[model samples]
Target: MNRLAALLLDRRLVAPDLLATGPIPDLRGPVPASWQGLSRTVSVSEGLIALEADLLELGCALSAPLRRRLAELDAWELTIAGRHIVGAMRSKVGGHVDHVPLFRGFPESVPEDAFDFYVRRVFTVLLQEPEQPCVLCGKVATVHPVSPCAHLVCRACWDGSDFSACPICHRRIDPDDPFLLVSAPDAEDDTARDLVPHPRLRLLSLCEDPWAAAEKCVRELLSGQAALRPEDLESVAAFVDTCAPRSARWLPDVIPSREGKATALAALLARAPETLPDLLDRHVDTATDVLRLLNAAMDGDAGLRRARPIAARCPAGSAGRCWTA
Candidate 1:
């Protein structure tokens, strides 16, 4: 079954009546054709994502202003997606378009010469030790390293090639590498299917209003660890964004990282700014954590940039620079 694209709405824009009331009408939009059941998952921060990995297929999905690739869009498309998010934060629909591809899950294109790509895979298989049985023939054979990439080629199965690039990496290797050959034919149909599976599709929630998203992250993010490991930043931000302010009591007693504590409190306080004093008194532990909250508030004053809480990047220890950067 095809999955409809999910929209993650900031709770502030959601009227209290709408949230308190029955099931609301979902904001509808056209989805990308590539977003089939199979696609990479995605993520986003309240802010601060490095453009490339923050948006690339292998990069971090969580970040703000702009995130990574889940679709076939370029930087302009990414910026447009970010602009829509920016507008949603400001509650402005004056000039914004309703439907745009915001997905970071784009399909990839492989080499056209199917057989050449398949046969080239032998170099990848040869990465195993030459002393072991030959990967191609399943028996011990004389294996020699190709010139530049140095991928071992099984002499028993095939001699060499005349291709310009390294078969495994598809990069330009030594032109004279004995493995490069023009005559290498492609694999048969059965073998082709086995090799064609693309990267597993990852589900990245983009402003989807699901309480489950927050609950799923609580066990993993709000751990007793002192400082957030570099990788935890994305998970932490996602948790804070998805969490509801009323559920603040559900927060862990001790949120370890200064960054984590501030993020949680800021996201909570954004919608319920009246509780600012109490949240500050209770959750705001250190001076740095206070600065983190202050930094978010400063950027998003008067609901102008309300998505600031999750946008706050920089790890805990980078105290002085955290506010400025």
Candidate 2:
């Protein structure tokens, strides 16, 4: 297994040459028979710009939003592959690169956002009566009960015993659950391991403009179908405060969540004091929005949830200059 872990995949597995040439990915190697006359390097030199589109055409197993992020790149270099592509054969030229691990496969039955689906699933399972409503669809139905925990599932929605834990309750079942067997010698008693699947590396590179690179990384976190996680919201606010306090494009045109709006708005206010009136007019939809923004500025979670709101110097007036709160 260690040997396998150390093994690098053939760079040809998803060759840039064949991918850019055709409408589909195929068993054909990099260069086609017709293109045999052209310089191989010249032909593929268009370089992986259509990468995301090609992957989508190939029916890649990645989730929807992830596909866009995985495609974000400025330039491609073979030398830098080792940094982001795990077990990648390093090239002569290199810089900072980071890897995003992709699970081999998981439930793709629904088009829901994966993280949002998991959280809603956990809540849906915990709060409802076992047999009253289907855990996934939330409809009252004739449900089949999984053993021991008796978490009712719509069998149509779930494949039985495919889970390491009760699909509904997220707890251990008896020894006979098809996913595990105490009788097997190699059954290590691991419950949480199910969440951590064997991952494949997706290579990511930064954009040349450092601000654009920072914006893209931060934007990916906010572009998800779900609201920013409480912890993640705090981290984003802190990061933006340090990085892009004044760039309006650093955030989306509309942020739907309350915590996200407040945390971000406050960060801008603290970092760039001139950020107020115009930003508030653009973002604040209601009185409550202003209150949350002010609350974060005035009395926050000790600046953990946002940047410490700062005071801007008052402009000189005919009357006199005085500091405003």
Candidate 3:
């Protein structure tokens, strides 16, 4: 039996009685060459989907667009040998040209919009949820983010002290990088609180070397205390690659001041720096451009140039800039 038929049969969508009906007038479209069963058939200019009763019911979960198309269609027309299906037309023409061809589920090339929509949705959901337990320490925290190296760490595994670098994925994060504290549920304001900059807590100053802090954050991600699913981790790693290069230097040091700042930043990427300094040089320009855009919306004004969210970048050598950097 065809996979679709098997799927339908398993779901109990079609009855055995219908199966023996000898190719009922299922005017779906040109049936697949492989379909075979009782002999009777119909040939419509268009093709139709032939699914078991349960399989048709399962279609309810499909995206709104696909479901709508399926819902508007009429019955599936069986092919003579059962190898093909004839689809019914919403509007029938007098001539044979109205017949539609059956298509393989897989298309040679998908529309750009459709492909992009799928890719974005797939990665977005993957990053948010994984099918398997985290690969790092194996703890099961529901809210884990991936490190640059693609390890899934739990919050408990990363209590913010000691060893840097993800144990499983091996992405490096500085111990001193500022981490955003989750807002307390009772707190009225939802603004994120930085772990650094506590007046009495001198050890956690904003001036703490950012690279070291980022390394620490990466370590926490790999420990599995904040566990992320393996697939989710991979997706986050993928998201990092598509993003443009970001500045690694101290973000607070480079907020843009006036007009023409965006143009200046585009020029800075050409200059190279060694180690952290190089990272910082790249960071300066990226940071300037971002701040200007954000501030642009202060009075309900629209931003002229929107900066892509910084969370898309590799979590290595940079973390102090906040989640949306």
Candidate 4:
């Protein structure tokens, strides 16, 4: 298999579910019929209208003030491909790129105060989920992040297994870790803010490798296809090894934690499409969780076991290992 396919084949297949940043549509309306057109693709929903409508409603619900602001903005210019919302921007002076469509525009030229107005407005609407009960548990959403499945689950109710498939589109979650967690507000003081990556963000990051697999899976999902490769199981094992332990204590209990990783491996072994994205999105309490789990798994292995102690004993040695003071 090629490197991309090889990555998928290496892990135990975990089916991807609704784990995208926002709700993307299916085949959108603006398909580039020939090679000359610029086609926009979003991983969330199938098309722009579907994506926009949802956000519009969400924006309105955020606040009457925000709703008024949205009403004042010029009409949007949109491109649709199949059900996917390919592109969106306001038809105004220096239209801004609508990355998530939570706001009308986010142009660099826009004043920070104006941008902050939009930002705060969106958050107000988002924070009002008590009115919109979760699709899974039917409870007010305290910390629900919508999965690709489009089903919202309360953080308290999410089992991390229900979304074992691309809930909305039915793609397998790649076994590569695509997420991280911060225990509390201060945990992220030293981290970068890449993806709304605040310390309190429910799930912090995604796995780099599986994100590639997700790209491929998106094609397969759109085409109604399935895939299985023996190498994927190995990839799952390797992916597990990537988890490094952190110092925080809440690292392991959030989701399937261990079971989530195991489930991905099992899916690879079974060669079935299970929702792996939801599991990958769990929070970690600390880096120590990753290290401890990895350390225990490496115990019986001759190569790793032999090397760990040597490095542990020589804190300042040539080896890359560092002692924990």
Candidate 5:
């Protein structure tokens, strides 16, 4: 057994019956006339395994083990050769190049972002419940086929927006194709019954409650469990504004009195220190005091320290004078 075949068999990525026998076909020649109408070939090489594939040519380097394995299989004809050759070859031989594994075992030849979109938005649709609600607006959806791709979007969401393409996959919609609607009544029923709020709606609710939202944001930032989404930052800012209203203007004095408030302030400073002076000037009577407190809080934290320089750029009237302290 060649090293490549042994590795693939050990990893369970390829079954023994799928192994090709004899010599690896040289694919460096002109395309065959019979294979002219099929998809273009993509080549991938990893260690001792090399594969070249188009619709007609699915060629792989055969190791001794692979050849022996093929010889032993009574069902060899019913394996990868008899199935979808291109896809099977891609799944089997496309792993690493120059010792670096491709994204999630996909070939480096595949466009990462496009393949990700295809897998996540297109392929995963098959696993989705027939009555899955619209991801946006939490509405019961009548699934309409978005064109130029196989992505489905809710009719209400599609009609509500002026989008010429799918919102999720960003694929162009075909106006010529009839809108095929698959009713998702269960999703609507769930929403109508209020059994559970949609994730987007839950986020909206959090944004509406500034204090609670700010606390949640601070906890997320401190834990380092997951990075905050762009929308989370907006919610955090809204919460900060609510707690330290621009007119009230006494942030440093009030924030230190509560642990949660202090942590939230520190998290905000850590996240966008460039906005520090502006935030303090807008919300604090004593911006210098706030700057000092923030600097002290962020003293040993690497992530927060990276933003210290930007915070130091605060204007003279705000934190510039106290920055040196």
Candidate 6:
């Protein structure tokens, strides 16, 4: 039997109408030529039946009672079978016409909205089935989300890892996709915190070099750390200036001015010795103002003179005189 028919029959949603009393066809034997593409299986004793056919043909074959039963249940999957054609019954009309058709008889050019609608209907019906244990840990599921493979997964199985893709189907979860369920905000926050490299040792192990380690340390500190230690800030500034000199300029904007700004500036100057001269030449006025600030914050001229190499590259004019003076 087709997947949809098997699902409905297993759920006991559409059983054979036994009181009608007629010779039920044997589905296990060879079906007639007229029923070539269709498969129908009926069991009067168990009150179970399975039916599969082309979209249009299935509409023409089901009994009035069975059709009425399916309609009452809002079975969009079966109801939408021949809906693309004109004069289709309103009861059978699918909500959206943009999805690709799942049946073999459907035209290849069917719209994407129609295909998506079909897949969604399948999921809707599948969700109604009794909740199954989580595919991963076999634990009782409190919540269900559609996996990339269209299977329903328990929240416990889903939450055990940091995977954005389905463990079963390996399909990536798109947050905006209608077919998938979005995680709750608190759950997402918990997941984020769990994934973050916490504790200095773990963060350090994840980094390949000193620069990366410093970046991780800074990220951890900025993401709601109660206080910033002076040594940590100084280390980050030095690492950025030494390994990524051009990135030094960004520190003034990202690091709060109240948090040891002078110490950071000093580290930047010490580590970015080579790039400092070119940076000063490019932004002579801004560099001069910053140097003046740094000098004023220093204890003596010896510390200020450390920036002399940068000052020598100033433009040869009034700007140059202003910088040297």
Q: Report residue 232 deviation for candidate 4 (angstroms).
A: 58
Q: Please, what is the TM-score per model?
A: 0.32, 0.33, 0.18, 0.22, 0.27, 0.23
**Clashing residue pair totals per candidate (backbone < 3 A):** 35, 1, 64, 79, 2, 10
What TM-score does candidate 2 get on C-alpha atoms? 0.33
Candidate 6 lDDT tens digits, 218-314: 4444333344565454444444544456445444334333233444444445544444444444333455446543542242222243443333322
After superposing candidate 4, which stretches have Cα over 4 Å from the reference? 1-44, 48-57, 60-132, 146-151, 155-157, 169-171, 174-325
lDDT of 5 at 298: 44
Quote the lDDT for 181 in model 4: 26
| Per-residue lDDT of candidate 3, residues 1-325 (tens digit) | 2323222222222222223234443334443334424243322211222221111111111212222233333333223212221121111122433232232211221122222222232233233343323334443344233333222345665643575764432346556751322223223421112111111110001112323433333233333334344443332222221121332222233322322222222222222112233433443355544554233212111134454443222233233332223
Question: Model 6, residue 252: what's the lDDT?
Answer: 33
Lowest summed-lDDT stretch of 10 residues in model 3? 196-205
Off by over 4 Å in 2: 1-199, 202-204, 218-225, 298-325
User: CA shift at 318, candidate 5, in angstroms?
Assistant: 14
lDDT of 4 by residue, 143-228 (tens): 33333222334556544554454332333443242112212223343111212211121111112355445444422222222332
Distance from true location, Cα of 24 in model 4, Å: 20
**lDDT values, one for every candidate:** 0.38, 0.39, 0.28, 0.28, 0.34, 0.33
**Candidate 5 worst ten-residue window by lDDT:** 197-206
Pairs of residues clashing in candidate 2: 79-91
Model 5: how far residue 246 lies from native, Å: 12
Where is model 1 more than 4 Å wrong at Cα?
Answer: 1-186, 190-213, 229-231, 299-325
Q: Which lDDT tens digits does candidate 1 get at residues 74-147?
A: 33333334433333432332334332222323222111222232333333233322242332343445555444
